[model samples]
Every structure is written in C-alpha cells, then in structure tokens.
Target: MVHLRNRKNNYSGILIAISLVIMITVVSLVFKQIFLNRNNENEQNSVLYIQLLNKAMPVINGINYNDEVDTEENISIKGQLLKLIGIDIRNPFSVIGKEISMFTIGTEDSSENNKVVKRTLFKINPFDVNDKQINKSGQDTGDTENLELPNRNVKVNDPKLKEKLDNSKPQVLIYHTHTTESYSPYANYNTSHKKNVCSVGDSLAYNLETEYGISTIHDTTLHNAIFINSYHRSRVTVNKYLKKYKDFKLIIDIHRDGMPSGNVSALKERTTMKMNGENVAKMMFVLPKKNPHLSKNLAVSKKLEKISNKLFPGFCRGIDLHFNFGSVYFNQDLSNNALLIEVGSQYNSVKEADNTGKYLARIIAEYLHSKK
Candidate 1:
C-alpha cells in the first residue's frame, strides 16, 4: 500500500512539472513573436508586451514585484529583453524601430522624398536665401526677387481685440505630443525638459509674453513615456485645458522631426537654415487631412506660412497634409485653431530651435493682432 501511494505521488509531481514547462514554453513563444515580428500592424502590441514582461519578470526571476520598489528591476528586465532580441537600446535607429520615428523614411511622410508627390508649396534653398521659390511639384523656380510680406504693424482697429490682447489672458496654448524628442549633441530622446521640446516651448512662451505681448501657456506634460497611444494621453490634457480656459486662440502641438536611423547628416541639412547670419532651425506645419476644421486650420497655416516667408524667408517649410487615408485627427477637431508644428529635425541644436521659437512667437503675435 505504501509503495502504491508513493508511485501515485511521483506521477502527480511529474504531471505538475510538465504543465509548468508547457506554460513557460507558450509564454516564451509569445514574447518571441511579439518582439521579432517587425511588421505587426497593431501598434499597441509592443506596449502590451512590455507590460506583460514587466509583470512576468518578477515571477520568472523569483523576485517579489512591488510596483513602487521594483522600478529598477523592471528596467533591468527590459534591458535584458532587448539584449535577448539582439537590440542595442543605445542605438537611435534601434530605438526608432521600437518606437515610431517622426517624418522618417518609409513612414507616412515617405512622400516627401518623391518630388512628384511632394506637397511642399515652396522649398527654400537654405544656403541661398535669394533662391526661394519651389513650385507645388517641389521644383526650384530660382526667383531671386523677394516676396513682399504683410506688414507686421498691420493690426486690426477693433477695441475689443485690443482689450482681449491686453487682458493678460492666454491666447496660445503650446504642448508637446512627443515631449521627449531631443535635438543634436544628444540622443534622439531625453526626459530632461531642459534638453527636449519643452525647452523650445519655454522659449516660445517666454518670447510670446515678453517680446510680443501675447499671453501664452506652455504645458510640459510628459505624454510619450510609454511611446504608444501618446496622442490619446495628450488629447486628455488638451481637453482639460479647453474645458478650463475659454481664451485660448491657438492650440500648438510642438514636435521635433526625426529622420531614418544613420541619416542624421541629411536631417541637419534639411532642417537647418541661415537666418540673420545665424543657423536657425527650420519649421514645418503638419495638418491632419481628416480634421473637421480643416479649412479653418489650413487658412491659419497659410497665413502663418505667408507671414514667415515674408518676414523670414525659408524659415517655414511649407505645410504638410498628413494621415489623409487614416483616422489620425491629432486633436485638431476640438478647435479650428489647433496647429501641429515640427520645429526642427532631431539633428538641430537647441539654440537653433530656440531661435525658431522666438520667430514663431513673432509670427503668431502678428496673426493674433491682425485677426478680428
């Protein structure tokens, strides 16, 4: 009887071990598929994989997972996973593959490379300011004559407009959808507000208030911490502001452009332009084609582009219509005045971007002052 009981217990133990092995094998296969399949159409899968790994790592390593205390351990697990998948997190290109690259090669903006479909109304030769004028098809016209810009002093004669401007109410709301996008002399992304798009937003807000007398609000919320559904997170922030403040005239989502991995040199050449004998980062206006307020937004962008070309030629890279076939609204439907502005590419220096912020503030001020 004793021998039979021991045999039964041994069979039960063996079955339990086999079950555990099968479960682990299934989990490993899932992880491998999630990480190796680069063409996965579901963008949220990566985030889900990370979250699952974060929870699973503790159990696999036999460590207690306390959410607050296991932060470093979670990061260590992520690093290990990256290594297991033959990915070097330090390489910007490798990181770009894991996350979406802004305006990168083979991305939605791939049309920028094909001159036939390039939507740039005018492409300014940064090397020669006088060579401004590229037609709709992206050909240089080489027109040396400068285009006359609207007068900056052309203000509306409405007393109500003047009062609104003078009331110290915020007229512009500047936020960053990809808040961690950094510039040249650093990696592609950073958490430091001083080194990222937040710095540009700061410069813009400061210039708007002190130099142009335009009250501005700069929201430095970190929305891209997870790198997925970032627009959704930022949309909540935008809605909070819209509900709280009624005076915001312009909603600007600022971002730094990104090029394909190993193409920093071309990015620099494309995004850097000479202005006032100094290198200033070029700016681009990106509009979602499906926005409900497309006409009003396009009008605002056109006005800004004209003002930029007149005052600071070549600083504005012509407006880009994006996501025409998709559902990326970019929160522009909430307000007709919403604008997504890419200040510069990842290779531009912080100073160059700051220079752009100052000029952008001036352009915006001119627009607000001229509006009825």
Candidate 2:
C-alpha cells in the first residue's frame, strides 16, 4: 500500500511539471508576439514606409499599379499592404485610402519649377448676388477702372499700326491659355453650346472677319489637357502662331473667370451687362507687366475699356494690370500687342460668353480702326 501511494504521488508531480512547462511556453509566445507587433509599427513609421507610401498612394487614388507585377516594388507593396491597411487580403476597399489620396494631392507643391503653389484659401472679395455694393450688372462698387501708366516713358500709340493691319492675312490672333475652361448650367461643359470658351473664340473670329473685315487667327490648342506645366506647353502653340503669322497685330489670350456660387458673400460673382435688352456677360482686360511694351499693352487695355464702356456701360471691368503676381510675362513679352481678356465667370452661360465675344470683336475692331 505504501509503494502504491508513492507511485500515485510521482504521477501527480509529473503532471504538475508538464502543466508548468506548457504555461511558460504560452507566456513566452505572447511576449514574443507583442514585441514583434511593436517592431512592425515602428517599421511602418520609418523613412522606408514614407517612400513606399508616396509610390503606393497613387495606386490607391486609382492610378494603375502596372509597374511590372513581378518586380520588387510589387512584392514590397504586397508585403506592406498591412501598413497601408491591416485587413484580410480578400477585402477590396478602404475609406482611409481615399482620404490619404485627397490629402496627398491637396498639398500645394508644384513639381514644375519647384515653386510653392499657393491658393487663396478664402475669397479675396466675398461675393453675394443681392449685395447693394454690387451693381445690378455685378460690378464691384470698389472695383474701379485703373488706366494709370506705370512710370514708363513709352506710350501705346503706334503710328504704323494702321498700315500693318491687313485683312488678306492673319492680323489678329486669339487663343485660350485655358482652352477647356467652360460654363455651368450647360450639360457636359465640353459639349454644351455657348458654354465652351472655344466656341466663343470661334464666334469672335467669325464676327471679326464678317462684320469688321478683320482677319483673325483662332488657335484652339487644348493647353490644360496636360495640367502640369500647361503654360509652358501653351507657349509652344503661341510661338508657332507668332512665327507663322508674322503680321499679327493683336494676340489675345481669352479666358473666363471663376467665382464661388450660391450666396457666398456680398460680391456679384457673375459679371453681366444689358445688350439689346438681353443680359450678357461683361468683359475684363488683364495687362501683364515686365514687358518692353508695358505702356503699349496698357494703352490697348484702356482702348478696349473705353470702347466696351461706351458700347455697353458697366460692360468693362476696366484693366486689371498684373504688376507683381503671376508670371511677369504672360506671352505678352513675345509680342508688343498682346491682350489677356477675361470675358466672364464660369457661372455665366456660354451664350453670355458668346455675346461678350461678339461685343469684344467690335471693341477690338474699333481699336484697330483707330490705329489705322
């Protein structure tokens, strides 16, 4: 009986020892997992992860990940998929990925020229449709015509302008820096009639040729298609015209302005005028500085302003002389007689843009006739 009791005790001791070993092994595994997880998190926040993120973020933003599936990049991306989002490989979507994409692109950093792209976070002039400060025509009461000369001795009057103006050849050149800029309330801004600025340019060209007997060259190059370095790309087209049409007296870059919609402020965002009992969009001239012909450009702007105001009061927003902001020369340096005209804002219908273009043709023709 004594031997039997000892045997039972030995078995119980062995069982206890086995249980202890099992507990130690389980605890060790738990600690090991915790340490690995912490190390993995640290790895995700490292410089390597950021480099990976920049490369991988584009994929999340719907950019195709077609960089050779068998490459090291693909393997790395797959391995670190958890860092991007820790989920089962079977899951197909993530809300955080889109948020990351928006944040990434929203950064005001331009790749071209290494310039810091700054956007006006808040509206410089708050616009409201019902503000008394804004005239019925949507002209800002404070916004006045600025025809002042910028301390330059040169004048805009050209004696040989009349002799140079010819109808048989291309005398006037009109192009859009932002060719794709279109108006609203029109279905598919690209296709909608009177909403497309290209059509407005066409109307202006037609009016000039038919009504005023002026020869105009309208170049419909889509500049904004390749959004990066668009101005540089547009330069190619502008230079081409300038070289081919050596007799171009006036090179006009037409664009429409943009403003916030729906009761944002006391500023009338959409510019308008009463033309033949119909409401049409008004016009504004932008004169860029840092040109040899600054005075000449200013003169042209003033002439257009005078004609527009005379033909349709409050139709002209006067001349917006760009002194410091923007590229000093908006291809204006390329030609002595260059004008950047903003017909109207995006809120205006294409019809309004077309109407402005028609009136603008007359104004330009009158200015050329004066030179002649």
Candidate 3:
C-alpha cells in the first residue's frame, strides 16, 4: 500500500512539471507575435510619414529635416501616434492634420506628379552666342557656363532684320496651358483668375501695353480641367485666335514649373532669383525638338533668352530643347514664333511671378522691336 501511494505522488509531480513547460512555451510564442506585429506597424507608419512629407514639402517652403537629428526620441512612435490622432507638436497648424483644412495634402491630379522622361538636344548659353550640344544621354558635350553672374555690361545689338509693328493690331498672344498652376502662400489648383497663372498673364499684358507700348492679347482660358489633355485644350484656344487674327507675331503658353517629389533644394535653386534689387521668379524657355517649325521656334527662344539675360543677368535659366517627351509640339507647330515659357516653379509667389512677367514683357518687346 505504501509503494502504490508513493508511485501516484511521483506521477502527479511529473504531470504538474509538464503543464508548467507547456504554459511557458505558449506565453513565449504570444509575446513573440506581439513584438513582430509592433515592428511591422512601426515600419508601415514610417513609410506613411515619408509619403506625407513628400506631399507637404513643396507647399511649405524653407522646412528642412536632418536625417541625423531623426533619433527615436525626436521622431518617436508616440509622436507618430499623435500625428495619426491629429496632433503635431512641432507645428500648431500643421498640414498633416485635419485642423488645416484649407490645403489638400494629396496631389490635385495624378498628372501633377506624372514622370516625364526627356532628352536634351541642346542647351543655349544665354550669355554666350555659341550653342552647346547635349548628348543623347542629356550630358553637355562642352564646358558648361558658370551660372554665377559676373560684373559685365551686355548691350543688345539689334539684328538688321525688320518687321513693321502694327499698333492697331495685337502682336503677341499670351495664354496658359496649365492655367491653374499656382504658387506659394497658397499652393493648389485654384480657379480664381486673380490668384493663379492668369494673374501673371494679366500683369504681362498690362506691362506690354502700358509700359512697352506693345499690343498684347492675354487669354484667361482655363484648360487644366483634365490635366492630361491640357495642351490639347489650350491648342483649340490658340487656333481660335489664329483664325481670327492675322497679326499675331508671337504665341506664348505660360506655365509654372514643378519640382520633383521631395526635392526642396532644387525648389530653392530653380524658382526664385534676384533681378533689379528685388526678388523675382526665374524663367525658362522650353522648345520642342519634334516641332515642324523647330528652327523658327528655336530662334525665337534663343533670342528671348539672350535678351532676358542681357537685361537681368541670371534671370533666364536658359533654353531647354526637349525631345521625345511631354507635349512634342507644345502647340509650337501651329506657329513659328510660338513659345512655351515656364515662368516659375510651384514655390514662387504670385507677386514674384508678376515681377517676372513685367521683365518678360520687356524682353518680348525688345525681341519684337529688333530686326530679325
């Protein structure tokens, strides 16, 4: 009887020990799964933060984030949770949250961020008369000019080619393809003619008529409703004017440039520049390589670039001959003197762009008065 009782006690102790081991193993697995899930959530949150940052960077200028300063404490998981809950301690009126409802965080349209692959045929040196050849790989074949302005006087030696200026008729037609392409302080698709690129066109037309004594037609047509076919819509507008008027010497399509996603450094460099003791947006002349009237259009671009740089050094970012991408003609095939001008980037203010418009009017007036 004593041996049987001792055997039962031993079996009971063994069973208790086996049950403890099984409980411990199950607990460990639960903890491991919880830890893994947390890690995955953290990774997804980080990715979401980056995407949000990219969208916000262009709208909010002069905000820089140092990678080294992004410690776990500075950008904690708790902080991310706070952001998700609509509280950003860093910025009181942060665009990240729903509190600032005026600005849309996402792109207005998919075409706004569409990737355009292009090849440069040539890049004109505004300061130099010589044309620089760009390889098919879009690299300069010759020594590139230093963009820094040097202390030198540039005089416009007008060409002997002459055309009669008809004061009774409009000589220039200025329009916007991406009409809603707006600027800083309020960056987004805005329909108000007072706020968007239409305002710049208005300024240009006013300056051309009032200051330069040049007849101009500024078309305030909105064509970016379907952004993918913006050029096509603007082309119809241009054709209407062409059919009505026979005296149109120059056809200009004005647009604001956009910086690549998350490239704030480029935004600073490309958009704004100082001209005549005031800050103004820089201008770039875009010429289509595939246009039927390439030579005439190229001539117009080169002439304007030269004139602009001569007047305001470093104001013109130089002529870019784009090939095999974007609007192949940019409506330049419709007219020899047609040009697609990018006045400023999305970061430039309407005031800055208007300043550029005033200067652009002067440039165009000079170009028009000169002998071809």
Q: Who wins the lDDT comparison? A: 1
RMSDs, each prediction? 13.7, 18.1, 19.0
Ranking by lDDT: 1, 3, 2
Off by over 4 Å in 1: 1-168, 325-328
Model 2 clash tally, residue pairs: 8
| lDDT of model 3 at position 281 | 77
Q: Write the per-residue lDDT of candidate 1 for residues 35-70, one digit (tens) a residue.
A: 655332123344446556657676554322222112
For candidate 2, which ten residues in a row score worst on lDDT? 64-73
Error of 1 at 343 (Å): 0.9
| lDDT computed for candidate 3 | 0.65
Give lDDT: candidate 2, residue 70: 18
How does candidate 2 fare on TM-score? 0.54
Which wins on lDDT, candidate 1 or candidate 3?
A: 1
Looking at model 1, report the run of 10 residues with the lowest lDDT sum: 64-73
Distance from true position, residue 240, model 1, in Å? 1.5
| TM-score between candidate 1 and the true structure | 0.60
Best by TM-score: 1
Error of 1 at 367 (Å): 1.1
